[model samples]
Target: MEILKLTEKNIQDEHICCAISDKKCADGYQKKKDWLKTEFKNGYNFQKVDVRGKVFIEYVPIESSWLPLVGKNFMVINCFWVSGQFKGHGNGKKLLQQCIKDSKEKGMDGIVAISSDKKRPFMTDPKFLKYQGFEIVDEAPPFFKLWGIKTNPKAEFPKIMESAKSGTCPDKKGITAYYSNTCPFTDYYTNQVLREYAEKKNIPLTINHISSKADGQKMPIPWIINSVFYKGELVSLEMKVERHLDKLI
Candidate 1:
């Protein structure tokens, strides 16, 4: 299978591997495409296999990363997915190697990715990353883990931002969601489904759309793209609106 790299010229018309046929996510899909167009200027890359499945990787330079991790001259993986029937076929390893090659060519210190203590939606499995030679360099509350593979022995290890270490939102009441255009599902969930659901329940809901890197850097959760907090405590980071609604009720 051929791997396609999305460029500014073709990104507008390309299917981004997620929300390919979901009419409900149409708005969010466009938002993600628009977001990628802007991030491309900031050294972001989105590559995926040419298949009708979610088998792709998205990455950017550490300096341009949206997450609250500090490191110099490294590449940060935002998303690495090889879902559906693509698993166990080495597609993931191939995609990951491409990122490593790109980072090496750019003379980066290494590559870093955010994972969790266990499997979670919107997060890569730490065990797979560990098997690929990544090691835990730092940890944040609520099971967020920073995984890194240093190309330079002397390079400083990446660490979670001080603000994110606590993993607790300031809003202690109602439903609060912090999301960004990084994921296509976020816009649909936050602006449409989730919002409507909350209103139907007569619950106060606050949705904060993270518009800049600085905003993401201060987010309590490492995975800030689509995190929901109930009563100031972190809840689901996944975009499953119905699942979240059940929890809320």
Candidate 2:
């Protein structure tokens, strides 16, 4: 049950293999590594895999090109995978919960997802995110575009954060989180801001690791998964999470 961070040192280990069983994929670790390095430079954060034993969730994150809603603070879940042997046992739900918790605790504005025709089977299976209270926010034929299904923070972030920074904003905290199939720090502003509030609220962080940038209407940016935690708790501070945005920019 370890969602360890993927670094150059650990990418070639058994954990990655456990994440993806495809022999071809395991051999492509070098290409993956090279991609991660380049993606990190482009605001794309990714990890090797979401592994719990032989099972794992492989995916990536995408930057919001939609503005405010998909602002620089948010991400779109493009790819998702559960090991063939680990399907249908609540692992997917746990994986999904991890993403929700991460977004809440990390104080990320939100997570977005576009279901691919390939994964449409599972993504549209209704039971995927519905039981968790996730709703279909948008759908554009052929595929469904779901946003804010888990934690939609609202549209008041701008006005709210502007006034909150001066009133004892919040302190950042040390978190046990998930990122890039590997663990990443506060390099991205969204992560940094969210992590800061975890200290204030105290929670645990579990993020979705975005694994690739090969976007073909399925995989988006190299991103972390969906959730984060702080002090082992889940808290939604979206509107208030950006208290320091102005000064930081």
Candidate 3:
């Protein structure tokens, strides 16, 4: 299968992996594209398979990454997804190899990604990452982990910033959500769907948009796509629905 690299020239015409035909996330999709456009200048790379399915990988220089990770000369994987019929087809490996190659070519120390001890929604699978030779470099709170494969043995290992380790937001009351257009579903889910759900349930909700890299780095959680904190502690990172909220609240 051929790999398509999204550059400033072709990104406008390409369909990013997730929410390909999702109407509800149309605005969020465009916003994610806008966000990518800005990051591309900072050495962000997004590549996907030639097929019309959710099979893609996106990475950037760690310094330009929004996650609160501290590393020098490393490439931070923002997202890596392979789903549907694409699974078990080696498409995921191909995309990952491309990222590894690109990072090595750029003289980066290594490549790192946000994952967890186990499978979790919207997180890189730790097992898969481990199979590909990445080792746990740092960890945070309940289960968040940073995984990496270093090309330079002497390079400093990446770590989650002190701010992200707390796993709790400063807002000590109500349901506070922080989000960014990093994913196509976040804007729609956080602003419209969840907002309406909270109102219907008579739950106080506050949504904050992490518009800039500086703001994102200050976020309490590494998963900036969507994070909901209840009474100062993290409740969930998944873009929750009414059914899910019923159990949590």
Candidate 4:
């Protein structure tokens, strides 16, 4: 499969791989594109398969990354996904190789990714990373794991921030969520769908948007795409709706 990089010049016409034809996420999709436009200048890279599906990888320099990781000269993978019929093909490996090639060319020490002990939504598969020669360098509460593959073995391994180790947000009230346009579903779900659900259910909701690298680095959870907390406990990281909220409330 041909891999295409989404540069600022071509991003306006390229589909971001996720939410390709989903009407509910149209506004969120544009928001994510806008977010990518700004981050592209900060060394962010988004690469995807030529086909129209969720087969893509996004990475950036660790220093310029929105992830809450501490490292030097490493490339942080913000998102890596191969969904639906795109699986079983070598698309994921190809996308990862592109990231590796880019990192090497840029003289990055290594590549790091945020995954979990097992497969979960919005988190990379640790098994896949391990298969690709990545090692679990650090781990946080509730299964958040940091995986790294260092081209320069002597370089420092990346670590999750101390703040994100808690695995819970500060808000211990009804419902608190931290989100960003990193994923196309976050903006609409957090601001519109969930907000209305919370209001109708009379549940308090607080939405925190990570609009900058500084804010992202200080987030309570390592998964910044979208995190919902209820009464100080993590509820879910995926974009949720009324049924999900019903069980929570």
Candidate 5:
């Protein structure tokens, strides 16, 4: 299968591999496209398989990465996925290799990605990355792990921020969420569904839209893009059903 790279010039005409046919997420999709255009200026890259499915990888230099990690001359993978039927066809390997090749050509010291200790929603599988020669460089509370494969042995390993290490939100009395345009489902759920539900239930909700890399870096949740914290505890990383939110609250 041919792998297509998304450039600023071609992003509008291409499908971002997630929420391709979901009308509800159309606004979120456009928001992500706009976000991508800005990131492209900072050396971010987005590539996906030619097939019509969620098979893609997005990465950027650690200096410009949205995640709170400290490392120099390294590439940070924001998202890497090969979903559904695309899983067992070696597409994941090829996509990873492409990142590796690109990193090397750019004189990067290594590549790093965020994962979880167990299988979790909206996070890459640590076992798969481990099998691909990545080592656990650091870990944060609530099961977030930083995995890396260093081309240079002496390169500094990446670590999660101290704020995220606790996995506890300061606001302990309501539904607090930190989100961004990175995911297409976030805006719809947070803005419309979640707000309506919270209002109906008389629950105070605080939704923080992450607008910059700095906001993401300081987020209490390791996965800042779409994380919900209820009563000071990390609840979910993806949009949840009303029943789920009720239960969490």
Candidate 6:
């Protein structure tokens, strides 16, 4: 079992035959093909796991800032899969190790994965994220956890978030703040300022921690307020924008 970078040659129709059902992954071939060209530019790490020429696993580096909240210029394992024939072969664990090795080789800080909980298999189990040393970073169920295969757990969450190159953003060319009810910075901002005013002072836009999907579906990402998002990009809004760096620092 070799965890390899997904090249244009190997990312094909059967790339994930054992990981996901043929029906589910059949449409992903083209998506992967498209991904090979666009993934790196978007500030993400995309790779596949192959067993004797059979590509069956994928690991995606996150394209967002939340991972940065983890101490080590961190990254999240966005997409991970392993073939059914290889289940319990320690392949999942091995694949993860390989990813970590690659991360260090690439000069990354460290990695965080949203893994499968103890309740189910690696793919669909919402609670499975705990197996890989990932902790619940926010109140949201599966999406807000912070993971690291070989990193510290007690480090403080960061206030200065260095954003990823790109990811899923609802707004185009404006900032999007995924504030969660559980995040302290998010709480401070929402309580103290006018919504639009924060957007103007910070640029991009501001989102209070609301019960809408627009805020964040997973972990309800309600913690950010002093962020500059240009059409969905989370950036450093301003020094005065963040309360932690402002009042606390």
Q: Give all candidates' CA lDDT scores.
A: 0.88, 0.39, 0.88, 0.89, 0.88, 0.43
Candidate 1 has its poorest 10 consecutive residues by lDDT at 240-249
**Residue lDDT tens for model 6, 33-140:** 554445445445545555543333334344343323324445556456554566667766676677777766765655655422333322323444455655554322
For every model shown, what is its TM-score relative to the native structure?
Answer: 0.96, 0.47, 0.97, 0.96, 0.97, 0.47
lDDT by residue (tens digit), candidate 1, 1-249: 988999999987789999899998888899999999999999999999988889999999989999998777999999988898999999999999999999999999999999999888888888899999999988988889999998888999778888888888999878888999998888887888788878888888988889999999988877767988888888788786567657656
Candidate 2 lDDT, 1-249, residue by residue in tens: 435445545554534332244443343444445555554445443332354444434333334221112333445443444656567767667666566565566566666554422343323334555555645554332233444453455632211112211211122343433333232221242355556655455554333334442221121211132223333332221223334232232
lDDT of 3 by residue, 1-249 (tens): 899998889888889988989999999999999998888898888899998998999998998999998878999998889988999989889999999999889998999999998988888889999999999989899779999999999998888998999888888877899999989999999999889988888889988999999998898877778888777887777886566567778
lDDT for residue 105 in candidate 5, whole number 0-100: 97
What total of clashing residue pairs does each candidate reach?
0, 42, 0, 0, 0, 24
Comparing 2 and 5 on lDDT, the stronger one: 5
What are the runs in model 6 whose C-alpha is more than 4 Å off? 12-28, 52-57, 60-72, 115-132, 141-144, 149-249
Query: Which TM-score value belongs to model 4?
Result: 0.96
Better of 2 and 6 by lDDT: 6
**Weakest 10 consecutive residues, lDDT, candidate 6?**
217-226
Quick one: best lDDT, which candidate?
A: 4
Q: 155 in model 2: Cα distance from truth in Å?
A: 3.3
Number of the candidate with higher TM-score, 3 or 4: 3
Which residue ranges in model 4 land beyond 4 Å of their true spot? 241-245
Question: Model 1 compared with the native: what TM-score?
Answer: 0.96
Error of 5 at 157 (Å): 0.9
lDDT of 4 by residue, 73-159 (tens): 999999999999999878888999999999999998999999998999888888899999999999998879899999897999989
lDDT of 5 by residue, 39-112 (tens): 99999999999988999999999999988887689999998888999999899899999999999999999999
TM-score of 3: 0.97
Between prediction 1 and prediction 3, the one with superior TM-score is 3
